[model samples]
Target: MRAVIQRARDAKVTVQGEVVGEIRDGFVILLGVTHDDTIEDAEYLANKIVHLRVFEDENEKMNLSLKDVGGDILSISQFTLYGDTRKGRRPNFMQAARPEQANTLYEQFNNLIKNEGINIATGEFGAMMDVTLTNVGPVTLILDSKEK
Candidate 1:
């Protein structure tokens, strides 16, 4: 599993000209799943993102977790994160999981984060989505279960 986490002042997802999910003062997560990903991978990434201390504290130090600042999340399924372009111009998506499996892990990851008492809004899985966000501090982080 891999996740690109962006600190957002506000974020929203739209499908077919209608809003699907949105959040304020939280994270905009582009989550990806691989063929080998399991519940463990989902759990690891979710925990890391939620506890990540990128938000600034009163002293202007980046030391506050999402929980500390009472933030929400806009989670989106993004299999394209596994796009591999080492060879040709077209990227290969062979590493990405099948939709059935990927969606399961994706849902599991979201449920885990929500279980932590943080509010979560999600884009429709496998749908063509338009996402917009005000990236606060321009703070972005990438988390990969394999990196651990």
Candidate 2:
């Protein structure tokens, strides 16, 4: 499992001109699942993300977690995060999990986040979406379950 976590002032996902998910002052999480990803990976990421201190404190230091700032989350399943360009020009998605597997884990991940008592919005699992966000502090992090 992998994720590109971005701090945002606000974020939204639209499918065919219809808003699917939206959030304010929180994270826009681009999540990806690989063939070997499991529920434990999803749970680990959810916990890590919740505890991450990326927001600023009264001292202007990055000391506040998502919970501390009362932020919402917009999670989007993005299999393309595993697009491998190591070979030819065309990107290969061989490392990405099948749609069914990916969707299952993705939902599990969202559930874990919600269980943590934080509000979470989500994009359509397998739809073409247009996501827009106002990035805050331009803070971003790439997280991989294997790394932990």
Best-matching candidate per lDDT: 2
Q: What is the TM-score of each candidate against the true structure?
A: 0.99, 0.99
The list of candidate 2 runs beyond 4 A from truth reads none
lDDT of each: 0.96, 0.98
lDDT of 1 by residue, 1-148 (tens): 9999999999999999999999999999999999999999999998899899998989999999999999999999999999999998999999999999999999999999999999999999999999999998899999999999
Clash number for each model: 0, 0
Estimate the Cα RMSD of every predicted model relative to the unseen true structure. 0.5, 0.5
TM-score of 2: 0.99
Model 1's alpha-carbon lDDT is 0.96
